[model samples]
Target: METAELEPQVLANRLGVEFYLVRQNNTIGCVITIAALEAHFWLESRASDARILKTFRNGYGRICAIAERKWLARPAATRLELTPADFARR
Candidate 1:
């Protein structure tokens, strides 16, 4: 799959699994595969969220590295269809 231009749903399909990145201290670290991407939205803790706390200490740099790598690997995914809420943008 071409990394870029793939939405979360499409990306999951390409990767053959649902994945979500962890954001801690404003840094995105590693990814965790959940029952579904939205699953993490409802759960307080996520599976595979390890390495995020760096032995329960700090993992900011690690998360930023992973996020940068993954995001750069993907293509530009534009907003295909804006919603009513999006129209609020001023």
Candidate 2:
């Protein structure tokens, strides 16, 4: 999918995560999930990282590490996103 056309809320719903907007320089970054487990991964990286490149080289372990160890998947929300101020305090 195109970053310019990224439907974060749709992705959130598909991934079963609470969607939140994160803006910087008036541009939206992502819809990260705050899940304590698994990973919030994206299909492609806008800016590639060497660590991520190495992880992909590791093959299946990459998927396992993300899905099992940390919430590194695309659908995960940010822990800070759903804070009380983001919703009703009561």
Candidate 3:
């Protein structure tokens, strides 16, 4: 797959979840779990949905980068869930 600039968008779903676009080719469902946010992005466990989105937005750049890398590694995956381990330093 071509390394196109994939812009992330807010997919309307239940609380504690969001999505990122995979360009014109396909839509990649990226799930940033609440546990990941709490562990990696300084998000409170009881943060509201708005707060959750805000935290996700604040770390959007890095999160998207990691998601993109994972997507590249497994191009055929329609959905990818990101965890705190994904953000851990190697």
Candidate that would win on TM-score: 3
| Candidate 3 overall lDDT versus native | 0.76
Root-mean-square deviation per candidate: 16.1, 14.2, 5.1
The C-alpha stretches of model 3 lying farther than 4 A from their native spots are 1-15
- Descending-TM-score candidate ranking: 3, 1, 2
- How many residue pairs in model 3 have overlapping backbones? 0
> Which portions of model 2 show Cα errors greater than 4 Å?
1-3, 17-80, 83-85
- For model 3, how does the per-residue alpha-carbon lDDT over 19-65 read when each residue is reduced to its tens digit? 66555667787888788889999988777777887888899889889
Instruction: Write model 2 residue lDDT over 9-58, tens digit each, in one string.
Output: 32323332222233342322332222211233332333233433333334
Local distance difference test values of all predictions, in order = 0.31, 0.31, 0.76
Question: Which lDDT tens digits does candidate 1 get at residues 1-90?
Answer: 344322232223322122234233232223323332223223224323332222222322432344455555642421122122322225
The better-scoring model by lDDT among 1 and 3 is: 3
- Against the hidden reference, what TM-scores do the models get? 0.25, 0.20, 0.79
Point to the candidate with the largest lDDT: 3
TM-score: model 3 vs. ground truth: 0.79
